[model samples]
Target: MRDVSLLAGVSRMTVTRVFIRPDHVLPETRERVQRAVLELGYVPDRAAGSLATQRSGFVGLVLPTLSNGNFAAMVEGLTEALRTAGYELLIGYTSYSVAEEERQVHTVLSRRPEALVLAASAHSATMRRQVAQACIPVVEVAELPDDPIGHVIGFSNYAIGRAAGDFLAGLGHKRIAAIGASSDGERRDLRGEARLHGFTDALLAAKLPADMVRMEGDIPFSFTEGARIMARLLDEAAPPDAVFAVSDLAAVGVLMECRRRNIDVPHDMSLLGFGDFEIGQQMVPALSTIAVDFDDLGRRTGELVAELLQHDDPSGIARTDVGFTLIPRGTTRASVP
Candidate 1:
C-alpha cells in the first residue's frame, strides 16, 4: 500500500480509501491509485484491513457435500451474489454429521466471518451454543425450521415430498414405494424423514391402499444405494408400480437397476426422484423429481447476508421461502397396468 501510495503521489490513507471505499475517492485519483497498484503488483492485506475495520469481508457457508449438484449450484449463486457486494465466501463441508457440522461451524467462525450460512437445520447442542455465542447473523438453508436461531431461507421439505406423493397418486399408481436414506443417530436425514412423512401422509390421505406404500432403505442417498435397495425391491413377490426416491442419485440408480434386470420403466414401473440432478434429465427416461431452486436459494441467502451486513440488523429479514416445484418427466407416466 505504501509503495502504491508513493507511486500514485498520494497518502497511504488515500490509497486505503481507494481500495476500501472507492466511491469516496475522486474518480481520477482512484484510477491513478489503481494503476499504481497494478504496476507494483501490490495486494491489499485483508487480515490487516479486517483488524482496522472489525469486518472480515467474508461470509461463511457450510454445506453437506460438494458432490451434490444442487449444493454446488447454490454455492455458485451465493458466490456471485456476495462478489457483487465485495464479500468472499468461505466454504466448508460437514458430510452430514452433526458433530462434524459443529466442528465446521467453529472452524469457519474462527476466521471471523461477518455472517454464516448453514445447509442443515439440525444441529448438536454444542453447535447451537457456538452459533448463538458467535454473535454473527446466521442463515439456515434447505428447510425452514419451526424455531429458527437466526434467519431462514428455504422451502418446506415435507411439502415437497407431499407434492411428490400427490403427483404419483394422481397418476393412478396404487402401489407406490418410497426409497429413503436411513438415518444414523449421529447423521440423521431430517429432510429425508420429513419428505417421507409427507409422502406417506399424502398417500394415506388419498385413500391409497395401506399395503401399497412400502418404505425401504437404510443406506445413504446415493446411486449405489439406490441400485442396491431397488434390486431388493424387485425381488419381492409384488413389485411396486412406482417408486419415489429421496434423491435423483438414488432414483437414477433405480433406473439403472431396472435396465440391468430388463424391467421396463413406466411400462412396468414408474420412477420419481428429488433434487432434479442434471444427469437425471438426460437419462433414457428423464427422471421426474421434486425440484428445489437451489441457485435461487443461494442468491436469496447471499442477498440476506448482504442486507444484514450493510444494515447490521439480523432481524431486518426473518425468513425467505424460495419454494419448490414437482417436475414430471418421461420416467413417470400414468399407470398403464
Candidate 2:
C-alpha cells in the first residue's frame, strides 16, 4: 500500500480509501491507484483489515462431495450471492464422514470466518459443539433440519421420495423396486434412507402387495453400483415392473444397465430417480425424477447468512423449505390403462 501510494503520487490514506471506499476517491485518483496496484502486483492485507474491522469477510462452506452436480450448483448460487455482499467463501469437503466433518469444522473455524454453510443437517457431536461455540451464523443446506443451529435452507428428502413414489404408483405401476445406500452408520446416508422409507410408506398406503415392493441394493449410492444392483434385481425370480433410485446418478445407472440388457424402458419397466441431474434430461429416453432447486437453495442460504451477519440474531427465520418437484419423462409411463 505504501508503494502504491508512492507510485500513484498520493498519501497512504488515499490508497486505503481507493480499495475500501472507492466511491469516496476521485475517479482519476482511483484509476491511478488501481494502475499502481496492478503494476506492482500488490495485494491488500485482508488479515490486517479484518483485525481492525472485526470482520473476516469470508464465509466457510462445507460440501459432502464435488462429484455431485447438485452440490456444485448450490455452491455456484451461494458464491454469487456472497460475492454480491462482498464476502468470499472458504470451502471444505467432508467426504460423507461425520468425523471428517468435525475436523473440517475445526479447520474452518480456525480461519475466523464470519459465517459458515454446511451441506447437510447431520453433523457429528463434536462438529455441532464446535459450530455452536464459534458464535458465528451457520446455514445448513440441501436437507431440512428438525433442529437447526442457525438457519436451514432445503427440502425434505422423505417428501421428495414420497412424491416420486406417488407419481410412479399413480402411473398404474404396482410392482416397484427401490435402490439406495444400504448403510447409515453416521446417518450420512440419512437422505437416501428417508427417501426409501417415504417410498415404502407410499407403497403401503396404496395397498400394494408385500411381494410387489422390492427393496434392493446393499451398496453405497453410485452409478456403477446402481447398474450392478439393477442387474442383480433383473436376475431375481420376481422382477419389478418399475424401479426408483435414491439418486439421479443411480437412476441413470439403472437405465444404462437396462440398455445393455436389451430391456425396454417404460414399455417393460418404468424408472424414476431423485435429484433431477442435467444428464437425465439429455438421455435417449429422458429420465423421470424428483428435482430440487439447488441453486435457489444456495441463494436463499446465502441471503440468510447475510441477514444474520447484519442482524446478529440466531432466532430470526430459522428455516426455509425450498421444496422439490416431480418431473415425468420417457423413462416412466402408465403401466395400465
Candidate 3:
C-alpha cells in the first residue's frame, strides 16, 4: 500500500480510502492508484486494515463440499450477493464431520469475520457453544434447526421428507426402499432420516407391514453410490416396488442403473429423489423429487449477514425458515403387478 501510494503521488490514507470508500475518491486519482498498485504488485494487508476499521469486511462461509451442484449454486448466489453489498467472502470446507466442523469453526473465528455462514446443520454442542461465544452473527443454511445459534435461513427437511413419503404412499407404493448417506457431515442426512421415518409411517398408516420396506448402505451422498445401491436392490429376489434416493445425484444413478437393466421407470418400478436439481428434470424419465429453493436460501443468508453487520447486534437474532416443494414427475407411479 505504501509503495503504491508513493508511486501514485498519494498518501497511504488515499489507498485505504480506495478500498473502503472508493466512492469518495476522484475518478482520475482512483485510476492512478490502481495503475500504481498493478505495476508495483502491492497488496493491502487485510488484517491491518481490519484492525484499523475494527471490522473485517469479510464474511466466513463454511460448507460440507462444493462438488454438489446444489451447493455450488448456493455459493454462487452468496458470493454474488456479498460482492454487490461491498463485502468479500472467505470460504472453508468441512468434509461433513462434527470434529472437522469444530476445527474449522475455530479457524474461521480466528480470522475475525464480520459474520459466519454454515451449510450443514449444527451437530456438536461444543461447536454450537463456540459459535455462540464468537459474538458475531451466524447463519446456518439448507436445513432449519429446532434451536438456532444465531440467525438461521433454511427450510424443513423433515417436512420435505414427509411430503415425499405421503406422495409415494398415495401412489400405492407398498414395497419401498431408501438409500441415504451415513455421514454426519451433511445436514441432508436429517432429511434422509426424516424421509425414512415418513416413508415408514405413511406405509404403516396405510396398513403396510414395516418389514416390506428396505434400506441400504450409509455411505457418502453421490450419484455413483446411488447407482450401485440401486443395482444391488435390483439383484434381490423380490426387489422393492420403489426406491427413494436422498439426493438428485443419487436418483440420477438409480435411473441409469434401471435403464441399463431394461427396467421401465414408473412401470416396472418407481423412483423418487430429493433436491430438484436441473439434471433431475432434464434426465430421460424426469425425476420425481423435492425442489429446494437453494438460491433463495443463499440470498436470505446474505441478507441476514448484512443485517447483523449493519445493526451490530449482540443479542443475536431468531432463526428463519425458507421452505420446500415437492416436484412430481415421471419417475414415480403406482406399482405394477
User: Which 10-residue span in candidate 3 carries the lowest summed lDDT?
Assistant: 182-191
Q: What TM value does model 2 have?
A: 0.92
Q: What is the C-alpha RMSD of each candidate to the true structure, in Å?
A: 1.8, 2.2, 2.9
Considering TM-score, which of the candidate structures 2 and 3 is the better prediction for this target?
Answer: 2
TM-score preference between candidates 1 and 2, better one: 1
For residues 216-322, write the lDDT of model 1, one tens digit per residue. 55535889888988888888898788999889999999999999999888788899999988899999889988898888889988988898888754445578788
Candidate number with greatest TM-score? 1
Q: Score candidate 3 by TM-score against the native.
A: 0.88
Q: Candidate 3 on 1-337: residue-level lDDT in tens?
A: 7788889999989988998889999999999999998998887787888888887888998887667777787887888788877888888876666677778888998989888998756568988887888887788888777776667787777677667767777777777777776643343355566666776776677776555344454545778888888888888887887877778888899899999999999897788898888889999889999887787778767876776677854464657777778777898764445
Whole-model alpha-carbon lDDT for candidate 2: 0.83
Q: Which stretches of candidate 2 lie over 4 Å from their true place?
A: 21-28, 184-187, 209-220, 335-337
* Candidates in descending lDDT order: 1, 2, 3
| Candidate 1 Cα deviation (angstroms), residue 279 | 0.5
Which of 2 and 3 is ahead in lDDT?
Answer: 2
Q: Each model's TM-score, in the order given?
A: 0.95, 0.92, 0.88
Best by lDDT: 1
